[model samples]
Target: MLAKRALSIVGGLAVIGWPFAVWLVISYAELHILLPILALCFVLRLCTLRGKTGALSRAFKGLAIAGAVLSVASIWMREAQLLLWYPVVVNGVMLALFGSSLFSSMSIVERLARLHEGNLPPAGVRYTRRVTQVWCVFFIINGSVSLFTCLAGNVHWWTLWNGMISYLLMGLLFACEWLIRIRVKRRYE
Candidate 1:
């Protein structure tokens, strides 16, 4: 159990720190070494997903598989350039997951809101759905920028966007959402 928890923590960090890892490793080490380490991260992520079954779980598993596939491709081709696309792929997968949730009866945000509120009123449901839509839009735009970074092939620029600027934008969005949610919640109360 202890080992599992540790692995889970490491896997989560790997996923979140992927671009940074790429930047750091490729700076001092070889792509060959990073590829295997990245593959291990994906495998660890997959192992952590064991026993989870749902759309969200499947989405996460798919992400790990995609990362592993990229790792394999980079290794096979001996092309470190392929490693640059990892962030783009990540954004695409997230876009798909969150975008697909919009078509379901409950939007992803609605489901999350339900977890805490238990019985979200109709207004809350609508709000969550709108929030989910906003997230979908965010993914589309963010993914586009990531693709641009991949295409540009400038490691410094790519790392700056994917590792720092992207995260900052996401944090800003999250903060705005929280503030909006507070205002919206007060309306329901």
Candidate 2:
């Protein structure tokens, strides 16, 4: 179980990190190398998801795969506009999953924990829901703004500002989730 959880975390990081790494590397080299690497990572990640049989997981998987495909397609399309749409597509799907789970009768966090392990405390569930809600809101707002900026074709200094702000917000949300999870674990212990 511990190994599975660790693998999931590592896999999630790779799914998120590989594209950014490719982008960073391409910053110093040719753009052509970026697409193939990004596509490979995306495809590899999509191939590795397991126990994602639930509706929410399936939806997330679909959206994530679609977003990755669209991102690569955008490169070929030569449309920076599609880059903005990428976040919107991925984040929108995540928001929908969170929103639906928030209203469900089942404990979403518990379900997620069970997916990783066997059982989790009620406090853990509450903390998970709260943190996931915040993450959903973060993605929705930033994603919408990014999509709008892309549509407007505004490549200004504020664009960098937007990217930085979004990154900071996500980082803070991730930290808060970790903190809440730790607090819940300590309380139970």
Candidate 3:
């Protein structure tokens, strides 16, 4: 269990740091060379997952499989450009996942919030739904930008946007949402 958690943390950091790693250190397009290795790691990680199969869990599995397949294809074809498409595919998948949650029985944010807060007040439910919608829109826009950067064929631009700018924007959103959530909780209380 500890090893699995450690691996999960490392994988998350690697994904987060990939753009920076590619841009600054591995600027020679050697990043794509690691795809196959990463795919194997992903396979190992997926095999370790143990839980009830829910929609969210299934979606995560789908993403893991997709990443593994993309990595394998990049290796087989020896095309570095395919690596550029990774963020686009990821963002698109996220857009779909968050968008679908809006109309489902529980919004993704609500589901997460419930884990801490128990059954939400009516206002809390409404707030989570709106927050989920905001996330869906953010994903759509972020994915579009990712697609544009991939097609633009500029490594520097892709690195800057996907690596730095996107993360900054996401952090800003998270901060703003957290501030708002405090207010929301106070109002409900």
Candidate 4:
């Protein structure tokens, strides 16, 4: 359990740090060694995957790894104009999958709740579903806006703003999930 939690923390850090790392590498023209470091981090992350969470985490990590490689290569080859948009595309794809899974999982949860006559209150279930749906929408909107900002060649501050907004929404989503879980537990007790 400790190992799983640690892996989760590390994975979260990797995801959040990746963009800033890329920006640093580009700004400092340190492509040679930083690229290899990024690749090594990706490999380490790949070695940590063990189950369903691992599988999904690995998928995103792989996308990030590939994007890092492509970004470095593009810069090295003087093709920044083309490869600059790679991260945007990768992030968009990841968000789409993440959003879809939230919707699907919520549907399954609701279906299972329906199996019992005196199951969870309808309002509670609806609240859970609605919260998840809002989260899905948040992911989609954050991803879309980030991609647009990246593609538009805006200043670095734009990306920072996108990151801040995404992280804020994610924090709220986590809080909502925790509250829902507490409610569910209370219902059973």
Q: List the residue pairs that clash in candidate 3.
A: none
Output candidate 2 Cα RMSD.
5.2
**Residue 132 displacement in candidate 4 (angstroms):** 2.6
Model 1 lDDT per residue over 32-144, tens place? 68778888888998899989998788888988888788877877887767777887877788888888888889998898889898999899999999999998899899889
* Tens-place lDDT digits, model 3, residues 1-189: 788788777666656765664454235665555666667755754654556386667766666676667667767887656667778877877888888988889999999899899999889999999999999889989999989998888889999999989999999999999999999899879
- The CA lDDT of each predicted structure is 0.85, 0.62, 0.77, 0.59
Shift in Å, residue 44, candidate 4: 1.5
Off by over 4 Å in 3: 21-32, 50-52
What CA RMSD would candidate 4 show? 5.3
lDDT of 2 by residue, 119-141 (tens): 66676667667766776777678
Clashes of each: 0, 0, 0, 0
lDDT of 1: 0.85
**Which portions of model 2 miss their true places by more than 4 Å?**
1-30, 50-52, 55-57, 113-128, 152-164, 180-189
Extract clashing residue pairs from model 4. Answer: none
* Alpha carbon deviation, residue 68, candidate 2 (Å): 4.0
Best TM-score goes to which candidate?
1
Q: By TM-score, is 1 or 4 better?
A: 1
Q: On lDDT, who's better, 1 or 4?
A: 1
Query: After aligning candidate 2 to the native by TM-score, how far in Å is the CA of 102 from where it should be?
Result: 1.7
